[model samples]
Target chain A: MRVTYHAVYLFLAAMLSTTLFTALKLFGVSPNLFIIYIVFAGFYVSKTEAIWLGLVFGFVYDIIVGANVGLNGVLYMFACFLVVVSCENVIRRNNAVVTFIFTAVWTAVLEGINAIFGPVSGVWPAIRIIIVEIFYNGALAVILYLALKRIFERLYDNEKR
Target chain B: MRKLFGNRIFVLLLTITISVSVVLGVINATKTKSTFMGNVAMVVITPLSDACTWVGRKVSGFFGYFGDIDELREENEKLKSEKKELEAKIRKSEGTDRENKDLRALLELSEAYPSLELVSAEVISRSASNWYESFIIDKGTADGLKIGQGVISGENVLLGRISDLGSTWARVTVLTDSGHSVSAKVIRSGDLGIVEGDLSLSKDGQCRLSFISKNSDIVVGDYLETSGLGGVYPKGIEIGKVIEIKPEVQGISQYAIVETSAEIETISKVMIITNNPAESTAVGEE
Candidate 1:
């Protein structure tokens, strides 16, 4: 039930990324909202749930964006797994700063995977785009992280009850 | 065996690794067509994307009205003068046109090609990632579109070819995508070359014309057009103007950098030349 509710939000993220977010391009790149969502799921939800959501919705994102299937799914799965592990063992903190930092880092990872798997001819240009996206997604986290956290916590509590 | 199966992280990693391998294999095997899930997703999202774009345009136009009054006035004056000049030219050309038509009839020449049956489409959304230069249009197989059919701007500039299609939408791989290439010629010198996308140059909204002989007569300001060598795009469609020329790393031949004629970043509409006029089921035609 919880997964279904979050799945709707995931679909919305994918839809917006292709629609309105496309108009929000900064330096030829858009923020990977899926990365932000996956990180949130990792920190707030259980590791297993986060990984499942990442794999499923990541593929959905790729399909909607008209990209190769499984590329983003695997990358997103790995990101969720990494974040869950890091939260439990390394960071042990769930705050706006952590969300900001994780979002920035994961955006680079996901975009890096795309550059490697996609038909990128040059390295420097791809790097520049990745850097811009990191900053863009990180800044978005700083602004929306608290709200997102609150909403997810409330939903998770309801699911538990 | 039970202990390993119970290890949650281990099972998750194993599942992910297997899924990744399967995906890579499938991608390699079928790189041409969309998957079933992709088609389903397109069906669900295309309408929403179209609606969003419509709303976004209206909203932006509403906000822009206040700031555009002065620019509109200047443009209106310029358009008025241009309209007068065009009207005079049209009046002068009417007689010439009739004379030419008579001469053509006398010479027993049929029109070179039937009037093009073009299906106009609106760009619904762009590629979500910046790595690929592509956009989804609001027409597809139901509109008589096919893969490899040339998409063009209203001014007849070749945008790209239909790379993939669904029932209601299609994806166009623009001239600047790394995966795209077109056979082209210099209109002035008639030197033939292959115009293709390079990742580095695509960032600057440019493509490279390669395979020019070391001593080809191509120059920086030369214009490029489709050579009709490839069956995909028809001949004489304007591509772009050459901006620069550079030597290949092997020092054997040089390539010219061509700036696309159409400002691709801002284009909102395109016309796809239907494969066959008879095949075109006009959207609202009986």
Candidate 2:
């Protein structure tokens, strides 16, 4: 049941990445909704659930973005692993600061990988884009956290039954 | 062993991810088209993507289309008036004989390429990043769209080409993506160069004509057309015009910035050329 729910969620994420996200440009960037979801799962869900979500959605992201097929899959799964492993013992109490740090670190690791592997002309230009994107993602995270929390709260309550 | 078996899903996921990553890396290095995986991804993802794009275009187009339609109508009127005025002068020159010859020539030019039968499709989604420029069209392999087929806007305007394909959807990488490059010529001077999308200029609907020879008699306001050298895009399709020229040295031009004719940002509809003259003949024989 949980897998089905997440599979539907993953498909919806792909749809958003391709269509609605194209129009929702701010600071020349839209929030990486999948990444946000991964971070949320890492913080709020079980370790296995988080890993599975990251792996599946990361692969989906790569296919939809139409870049190299496995780049995002590997990178996103690793991001989730790092976040979950790091935060599991550390940030169990404080939701706000932990979410901020996790989101920022996730953005940094992914964007950093992107800059190195990206087909840009120079590292500085890549760095510039990455920094702007990271900030945009950071700002968007605040808005999504509570809404995501509420939505997942219901999801959790249903699963409990 | 039992605990490890239970925990080993993560191990299995990581192993699969790494293996796929290496395989994809090799594929990227070799530049092989993803005939299998690409088709699968498109087949699975495109219908959903297309539905979303359809809703997005209609929802957004519902309100935005009114203003856009009016502006386009005005532009269309001005162009029609200019063409009518030209036709009137031509009619006065040699009566029906000259017009008949011109019409025949126009027909022959279209026949020269062979794939005059175009399939119209609505754009469902555009690449959502500055790093890429591609869109999903509502037609696919089922519609006979092949990889590397030419995509166009109007009758003679160059848009891009179909880059990837599925059964029901195709992805078009427009001319403005930094990764996109096409062979083209300056219509006025006959100077040839590869027009590539510049990442910086693409944001404003522009690309750059690169590797232009030094001795070319090129200047601003010169129009460009596809040279058809790559065999991907059709020949003589209007691409854009030179807006600025940057000189390499004395008596040598390095490159010129060409503004694309297609308003790719706001464009919502496009056509794909599924059959070239050769393919049409092959089909005719079959």
Candidate 3:
């Protein structure tokens, strides 16, 4: 992807994640648009490019949110790293099933990390959050994947032309 | 090992991962929101964040105005049920001067407390993290705001406090946010416990009232209010309702979960109790 495209893409993702995503929460859990975007973009891009984009945007997300500074960046960067790594080594293609599973695993890992460091009352409750969020994020990820695929496909075509 | 280190992406990932982890450790250890990088970024990011929040809220509100048929149907059913209950209660109380008594009581309450300085503000943005609950409101030190002031939805409902502030903006960490604690009591039984926000129950719009004794008379459906023990949150503000209770091995409560009365998401405007009457009294005494 062009640098400008990446810039615009992440910018839109951050705006949505912070505002629209937070506002339109379903069952009080909004989709983590940053995570969704990074994961989606990571699939189509080179490993180095994906990691850099993730690192930059992850830092931005962490700074803006500030629950734990650098924590969001760490998790998101790793999530992108692992997803791209998985694509090369594990998954054959970025199909719906693969994307769903990747999103689910990525969400679980991030939630686990968040829970470990986050405030908690019990294990079961933390697990409940992880489960609920994974499903919410996973479902959203599939839809986002298809939409992004269409958009990126067009962008690639434009670049080729 | 040489070849692994030779690869640039791996090196970058490893370096960033360690750097960010170390940074997280440092930030967590010392102070909140004091990082140099963060402070510098705020110069540019703050306005963009504020605008995004503003536009987001407006757009969402615009859409929310269009009623969803299914939600409306459910609301209609709920309202119809509530109407029946209200009618029954109204008929039962037809002979009494209850309305007059209630008004007189309200009048007495209004007279008892000293006049509070309230600053009206608009909610501009929500916290970027779901794990934590807070939002930015468009009022700050410029408007006589300070740290630890109480925020409310309207009259009696507790919202949160001004955790951090800019010159003209402040972040109100909602009562539902984890790491937030409110000293509150069960109004019915006078059972006292600290209502604290827990991340686990946050998604369900609930908080936890901890430190209730083993044999406290607290029960389900008991109303909770700010106990005024802490002197931060004003006394007698309705916080939430007890939804569920968790018990320890010895039958003592772990905590009682409370569903907050304020829907922090949909609220566009809030009232800040800029100067608590109790705090003012303390100031006067000294």
Q: List model 2 lDDT by residue over B1-286, tens digit each.
A: 3443455655676577568667767786565355577668777777677788766654554554464688967866887777977755754664355435534544554455454667777777777544667888889878888888888764457778877767888878889877788999898888899999865676567988988887789899999988767767656778899999897555455899999998675566676766673334321122
Clashes of 2: 1
Q: Provide the TM-score, chain A, model 3.
A: 0.85
Candidate ranking (lDDT, best to worst): 1, 3, 2
lDDT of each: 0.77, 0.70, 0.73
TM-score of each: 0.81, 0.77, 0.79
Clashing pairs in 2: B114-B277
Model 1: CAPRI class: acceptable
True contacts kept of each: 0.50, 0.32, 0.59
Clashing pairs in 1: none
- Candidate 3 has an interface RMSD (Å) of 2.4
Give one digit per residue, the lDDT tens place, for model 2 in A1-161. 66777777787878877777666555445568778778776765666667667777787776676666667777788677756655555665436555666787788778676544545655655566667667767766777778767666677763321
lDDT for B132 in candidate 3 is: 75
Q: Which ten residues in a row have the lowest lDDT in candidate 2 chain B?
A: B277-286
Q: Estimate the overall C-alpha local distance difference test score of candidate 2.
A: 0.70
Q: Candidate 1 at residue B237, lDDT?
A: 76
**Number of the predicted model whose DockQ against the real structure is largest:** 3
- Cα displacement (angstroms), candidate 2, residue B40, comes to 3.7
Point out where model 2 deviates above 4 Å. A94-97, A154-161, B1-22, B35-38, B58-115, B247-253, B277-286
In model 2, state the lDDT of residue B190.
88
Q: Which residue runs does candidate 3 get wrong by more than 4 Å?
A: A88-92, A153-161, B1-12, B15-19, B34-75, B78-115, B252-254, B276-278, B281-286
